[model samples]
Target: MPEHLRALIVIVILATAVFSLAGKTATQLIPARDFKRRRNLWFALTLLAFLTHSFWLYAAAATFCLLLTRRQEHTPLALFFLLLFVMPPATVQIPGFGLINYLIKLDHPRLLALVILLPAFFTLRRQPGVIRFGRLWPDRLLLAYLLLVALLYLRETTLTDSLRQSLYLLIDVLLPYYVASRGLRQLQDFRDALLAFTLAAMVLALIGLFEYARHWLLYRALLGALDIEWGLMGYLGRGGSLRAVATAGQAIVLGYILAVAIGFYLFLQGVTTSRLQRWLGGLLLAAGLFVPLSRGPWIGAAIMLATFIASGRHALKRLFLLTMAGLLSLPLLMIIPGGQKLLDLLPFIGSVEKENITYRERLIDNSLIVIERNPWLGSVDYRKTPEMQSMIQGQGIVDVVNTYLGVALEVGLVGLMLFTAFFVTILQGIRQALRRLPRHQNEARNLGRALLATLCGVLVIIFTVSSISIIPVVYWSVAGIAVAYVQWVRLQTQPHATLDR
Candidate 1:
């Protein structure tokens, strides 16, 4: 925690206590007005503190929400979940500070992971199966996954390191997919989950944006003293006036969520939304993604928007307006340098170490090499090729940024095939949903389709970065809720074959 934030928390507590004691029942008797006043005071303090500790404040806010809320308070809780989902990925490395290390440890993503894995564990009661798979997706594929993991463990010529990794992957990585799949098999769960997440995402995004623009008395007076600015520049390859990440670790995250949000906004309200709202929401999402300056996300957002306009048949006037805007801005982008968010990506485009391209190229090269090694059964610890004399002379584990390769590295060819099977099943499910949606109910499946598209984009981008960087916990938690909600609604109205659909 920042120094001023610590002080602010203390002050808020003191004021709350003092006011309550003066009323009647010690700390519990504070007048409602006084309670709100103190809360507002702390809200301001908290917002300022947020600049320095975006991830922490966001996470705590979500946690506070979880602690205070019951499952019944669906609306508020749903909103809070979205903000939690939006919490930026934390690096949390504290050099020369041992105590702080434990306080904000990133070594283990405990709370986030626990929320998913524990529930799944208890739900399964220790069985190594997708508890809901018998009802939702085919059971054979999941069983195949188990067999694949087992195979990875049993290989004779396998590197010891690969065997250890296969074990971890079977649990740590596989567990999440299992939990999400189970939760989302129900439609109401999916609806409530998405509802909570969407509100939270908007609140977090707006709050972060507000603080950045104003730099109010709370900011100039307090956070300024702490040398913290509420912005997303740090998440960029460069910092200090780069652009707004808005409580996200990377531009891709912001884009992914915004794209999802736009999809939801359109689908939920559909043609009922006012023209003005449609325009404004479009602008908000566009500007939101523009600030993060991530090319992959930009591409994703563009593809989604284009797909939406083309496949879903959005208003032609709006599309024309957007096109005109893009054309008009081209000159400014060329002349003013801030015009091209993707082209001006800090370290990649603007800096001397333009190694981003070459690095990606090298990743592809490394992946090909691994495939060539043991083309069918898979190579052991191909990711950790540093120990092998053939791969690299003195490098660490092969820095293959692609997540597919990462999965392949730990689980081997069999695991990869099982993963491929899982993906195909999901794709089929989504395709079935889209096909079943009525002409009058385009909106019914659009959001689900949009989410699937976003996931596809994310999967593609994860080839460049680790997808589960402690950032994905809250994200997937909420995503599971959405899938559950959608599936539940559909199932309720139908044949019940798919979760009674």
Candidate 2:
């Protein structure tokens, strides 16, 4: 808000764009180390600029471009980026002051349209590439989902929310599938798309981390200005120290993403050479996860760890690593003064944990209450919830913490039922993939395991977080990739089984 700060942010944005252009282009031409350094500089600048939340859009756009260009080797990277964006959400936040706040806000839609849709637009323009639409694994279900959401929206009070929901499905989910189905019909294309996505995430995360730190410095400076009268609003605006959630919305989303990265790395580790190298890679990923200490991600991390420990053959190594890491971080966790301070929230957490809690319980309770009054299909409105609006007006605002419940609250029972089916079908896909994996194919098996772990992690986070706006991008992107992988695997196993043949 301050003139100096605003100038600082604008300068940071320009600097970032320059670094991005240079780094991305140079990485193509120069040494890998040099490329990483250039990207690191861009990241550092982005972090410095996060205080104003301006450069984030630029970062997101830059990332989308970088990946779109480097289409060759990025699936693992894309999955990693997806995880990074998932937890430690991509919203703004300052630290160690004020309300100890959390907010679920997405980046601007216009930028998103430019970043995501433009590529599809270009693809569409070049040639008439048709999708052999056979009620595909996800496509069939996605349409059903669209229809159900539309119905709920048609009857809803908040027309704008419905519009966004439809837009998210059409753009994020459908566009990617449409583009990928044509673009990634081949096995290599599938891998390339995923890798490109991963690279994009790393680029953005590095920048987000950079700007996150910059915002922290600014927050500390502001806190210093406040001196004795510490404020909550400023810190809440910036997010906490664990990670500087940039365009991804929240640090939890960021953490979840980092966890997903870990999952990918674990998959890679199972196949990569040298045990020591694998250990280092795993450590690097775990360190990445800790940057955003969101509880949802913590839960997600636990899920990932459990999966690793139960991965049968690989259990010993992963469990050993986790055991060692836990034993070590425990001392640090205990000695930290702030770690214990969080105990004060035990009552609130416990209250929320109760069979009938506040945010979680309230949504379920309200929805059921509404349903009871009008059981036959239930009342629906396109307008914002009057009850929620009052609360928002009273204390800014928040969402139904649970993602599934949030949808229910937004669209009522029918929407909830359909969404539940959509998710269940996705999980079913994962299960089928896991079962169908060839016994001797380590790469496919490990990859499938990693995907399964990530899906589980995401599911856990959604249960406790209102990640609606993010789900289409987050879930659907992976769903598309999963579809690609399945097609790829089936082709690899039984090569001549194509419709074209």
| TM-score winner | 2
- Model 1 scores what on Cα lDDT? 0.47
Q: What is the TM-score of each predicted model, taking all chains together?
A: 0.63, 0.65
Alpha-carbon error at 157 in model 1, in Å? 16
Candidate 2 wrong stretches, greater than 4 Å: 1-131, 156-168, 180-234, 237-243, 270-281, 308-358, 374-394, 468-471, 499-501
Give residue 284's lDDT in candidate 1 (0 to 100). 55
At residue 362, give the lDDT of candidate 1. 67
* Residues 196-273, model 1: lDDT tens digits: 344334443443344334422122234244334433234233333343444454445555565555555444334333
Judged by whole-model lDDT over C-alpha atoms, candidate 2 comes out at 0.51
